[model samples]
Target: MAPSRILMAAIVLVGLSGFADAPQRYVVSYSVSDHGVAQMRGQALISEEGDVSVQGSDQDGGHAFNATLNPTDDGLVLVTSLWRGATKLGEPTLAMERGGQAKAEFGSDQQRVVIEIAPAD
Candidate 1:
């Protein structure tokens, strides 16, 4: 092989590797409904490690939660907690679909939440 051709190939490989190492970022927005009222509006960050950070506002001040996601046979299972100051308020079971939607239920299914994501504007 010619020396110039070999150098060009090496440059292409380096550029390709850089592209492969880039991280993916997604912004998810969702709402929760309770009784006949839409109670909350929130957003979450889904990272490469399947870790999530979510925050929203409702009638009860502002709320934030964090959890790690693990893939299951049925779907993605999430364990989340509510926080106020340094106190741990509640932990709940949540479910997520890869590249789809997610929901978290609270208080005996009295509350149902839905999350959806799309390309950022």
Candidate 2:
């Protein structure tokens, strides 16, 4: 099968397995070295099949964002954006860590941001 088809299959399998119930909303604090400190409140949905969806926003500007993390045989894949609607503003495939904590890195027109997510409570 093609790679895209396989990915689609995995997504479907993960969705059907009910992994989406494992995560919940939480507050995450992140640091951007030269920029400053930023905090966001978002939801993390962990599926039974190893898929994760995390979303959050900056309270000051209401700039919301979300990310979907999918675990594969190799590692994890991450997709993020800065919009609330169905349309994704920015989608970048960033590196991720397995098991305990995961991290994502992406660049925008202005700056580069790295996000780290710990296990949801």
Candidate 3:
């Protein structure tokens, strides 16, 4: 059997429309891939906060995904909890800054899931 891949992307636009040159729009792109193959992808425009999820079936088996995002005290950064089949993955944090990024990989010998968040250009 082959491994499955899931990619999620999130983009946020804040502040007034007049400020077009301003960096008010934050882009968050999530990518979950294995062996350069992608089975799922996601993108979102968040005002204050946002939630993105993807569910589908591939050659391996069925897949289910769920997640919610919330603002942090420092601003421009978000945090969300991860779960894999009732197992608490972790409280991963999301950052809009290019220097600040988060990533985590989990799975067994049969399968591997790599979750990554970037500045989304």
TM-score, every prediction: 0.49, 0.41, 0.45
Clash number for each model: 0, 4, 4
In candidate 3, which residue pairs clash?
8-30, 9-42, 9-43, 10-28
Better of 1 and 2 by lDDT: 1
lDDT of 2 at 102: 59
Model 2, 23-102: lDDT tens digits are 44322222222233333334454532344444444443444555666666775555555543444445555544454555
Question: Model 2, stretches more than 4 Å misplaced?
Answer: 1-34, 37-61, 83-90, 105-112
> Cα deviation in Å at residue 84, candidate 2?
9.7
Residue-level error in angstroms, candidate 2, position 10: 30
C-alpha RMSD (angstroms) for model 1: 5.0
Count of backbone collisions within predicted model 2: 4
- The total number of steric clashes, by the backbone 3 Å criterion, in model 3 comes to 4
Candidate 1 on 1-121: residue-level lDDT in tens?
A: 9999999999999999998776444565555567647676566766434677666655566766666555677656556565534555456655656444455444435665554443232
Q: Alpha carbon lDDT of residue 61, candidate 3? A: 57
- Residue-wise lDDT of candidate 3 within 1-121, one digit each (tens)? 2232222111123333345653333333343455556544444433335666555565765444544545566654555544444555455565544234456565553444555554444
Highest TM-score against the true fold, candidate: 1
lDDT of 1: 0.59
